[model samples]
Target: MIVGLLRSLSAKVPSAVPRIALTMKPQVIFVLGGPGAGKGTQCTKIVEHYGYTHLSAGDLLRYERKRPDSEFGQLIDSYIKEGRIVPVEITINLLRKAMEKTMTENENKFRFLIDGFPRNLDNFEGWTRDMDGKADVKFVLFFDCSNEVCIDRCLERGKSSGRTDDNRESLNKRLIETFLQCTRPIIEQYERQGKVRTIDASHSVDEVFNNVKKILDKEG
Candidate 1:
């Protein structure tokens, strides 16, 4: 298993870089949000500025779904469409494999920002097992945006993305159910642990990213 590892002491660290260290296992920063909450924008900035690998769980599942020959292709696809999480074992294996590949491929380069993962209590449990029960969770970034804004963004993205699931009805379902069934408690879990940071995602793209930058800076 190729486990991707990222170290902070790489030469010529960026000015905004945090003072994290190399780890046998990569540090995970989870970015949580409702659909279309500008998680992607913040993730992009995180990668560009702070040297983190952004892993979108939705994208990963979608890619898995596209491989029709795979056994769980349709099963995984169905779960995502209903704004439901895939089975814990399946998800954990996929993420672990991906992370391992990343570690080996990047020579353990950057911290990993996992977007849309640990969508439920079970997902969290599975993740703990996958991480050998002692995973390092840096923190959670919650992109707080109104449902209306999220719907608008999903609709906008759907027009060009060839993703049928991004349509109005499906997106509405996703937004409502995602918040209710998945994100809310996870947010609270992090909050209880004092690891949740809420970001106002109602602003313009650049403005939202600026807020994210400030948070990362403070944490670093």
Candidate 2:
């Protein structure tokens, strides 16, 4: 059923990664928020203060989409422009390689802040199954913000962000269908696990990070 649902949403997943498990148990904190919810801004602060490697799922996807020879470039471009989630296989593969690269580059420095990932329950399921539960998730850091604020911030960012999906139509559909309809359940599931640290993100940069600082200080 999960595979069927995923196929309905995107391309058929390649079966190459039936069970590619992460060998290391890195300290990872999932940084989740809707677009323009300030996840990147706060992730920078967290990295500066905590010496953690910040791996953003959106960033990786964008990088791959622009690569001169990336196999997933066209697929990623289509999905981004249409406000559809990329197949979890491509996303998880990117994240897995990034995480492993960080681990290798820094040896014992394993603290990681994975941003803008597991956007829906399908993504969460894909991560658990593919990663084999090897990564130790410290907690999920969720940013709570209103739709108006998020849209406003995204539109402002779109002025120069150069992202394909930053336009009004794309942002509106993504926020409604993906963020509210899908991502909320991921937050609720993590909340039930007592692993969610919700931060009010409708404030000024410094104001929001001040709250994030408190949560990380306690939860990190």
Candidate 3:
């Protein structure tokens, strides 16, 4: 009689469980790679194809450094030269400001293809407040290219950047330092979540953009 009662209670409790449905907030794609990994090129494709608002943190930082009296301008310049991510609070503030601008200007119709902002896990943690705990990463596109290819491209684009560190030694050091200190675990974290998408970037610019377009197309 006790066994019969126990079985009946278990059956009732199973049906009484709450029926929770999963809902995803808007998708945000972050493009990450070493310098000269064609992130800007791919960002252009995403913006053109899917109407994503492109926020290039490097460009923002570069512009800020041009102002002679800008606070943190010199520090930002030195950090970029070393291929290191800026302090978490500074980057988070910049990102938040950009996001706010995009949302207001677009009336919340904009999707973000944030380029080169979050460079470490701490940045990721800081971003949680923005999402209100309902944040879901659509994907992390890692532009996988060789250091040799990156260095070559950086040198060829000298007219635009006019940067002394665009040369072979500094470029190589940047890439090596980025790999050693930044990318490995971040890649692994996204891989564990099944949100990492990689593209072979040793191709022509058009070819790489084509690959990027294919990935962003899925969300549209």
Candidate 4:
């Protein structure tokens, strides 16, 4: 069912885009976690130590929403304000463009820490078709943190973060609808493939990254 959806969506990509996607083979590490699960924090550490490009799906969406003439800006803003996941097609297009741009500019091997992506089954399917066999997901990094802890962290960060979705109202929806309902199944799928590396994100920043560093060092 999901594969069929991917196949259907693949035809929607522009003719020239697939050629670019096919040529830019990158080592992709998907970073998955709930809101305030420290995905961004850990991704920064991974980038500094491993030289991987950190592409946060949330950041990409936020930037696109603020872009001067983006066609998806209003639509993205509505979904984000409601704490609903954006459509997979839009998200994957932004991700693929970012990956292609980075890969084209750099002569070295491309390694990407794609944070908070493949948020649901549709996202996973879209990514598979969109990349056109160029990149393989090396593994998924799942940051395990309790909802109570996550909410507290988000609230603290919200005081200064200025992100609309960081408040209590949207956090509730994101925690339940986005994380539990959508993301958990995606993690399970990767777990079945033996491609998931779980990290305890309930700890201090240093402690969490210590665990992260170990995994990256061993994996890379």
Q: Evaluated with lDDT, which candidate comes out highest?
A: 4
lDDT for 40 (candidate 2): 98
The predictions' CA RMSDs to the true structure, in order, are 9.9, 3.7, 14.8, 4.3
Please, what's the RMSD in Å of model 4?
A: 4.3
In model 1, which residue pairs have backbone atoms overlapping below 3 Å? 2-100, 4-103, 5-108, 6-108
lDDT tens digits, residue span 7-120, model 1 = 221222223322222355677889988889988878988899988888888888888878868556767677767766666666555666666667767765547888987787
Q: Which ten residues in a row have the lowest lDDT in candidate 3?
A: 17-26
Model 4, residue 170: C-alpha shift (Å): 0.4
CA deviation > 4 Å runs, candidate 3: 1-26, 129-136
By the lDDT metric, which is better: model 1 or model 4? 4
Q: Residue by residue across 51-136, what tens digits does model 3's lDDT show?
A: 87787877777776677976666767777777666655555556556666556555554477778746777767666644444334
Question: Comparing 2 and 4 by TM-score, which wins?
Answer: 4
Q: Model 1, poorest ten-residue lDDT window?
A: 1-10
For every model shown, the clashing-pair count is 4, 0, 0, 0
TM-score-sorted candidate list, best first: 4, 2, 1, 3
Give TM per candidate.
0.84, 0.90, 0.79, 0.91
| Deviation from native of the Cα of residue 129 in model 2, angstroms | 0.6
Candidate 2, residues 113-150, lDDT tens digits: the string is 99988899889998887765668788899999999999
Instruction: Itemize residue pairs with steric clashes in candidate 3.
Output: none
Error of 2 at 198 (Å): 0.3
Runs of candidate 2 exceeding 4 Å displacement: 1-24
Per-residue lDDT of model 4, residues 1-220, tens digit only = 4344445545654442434543547889999999999999998988888899999999999999899997667777888999999888778788878887888888464899999999998888878877747787999999999999999999999999999999999999999988999999999999999999999999999999999989988996
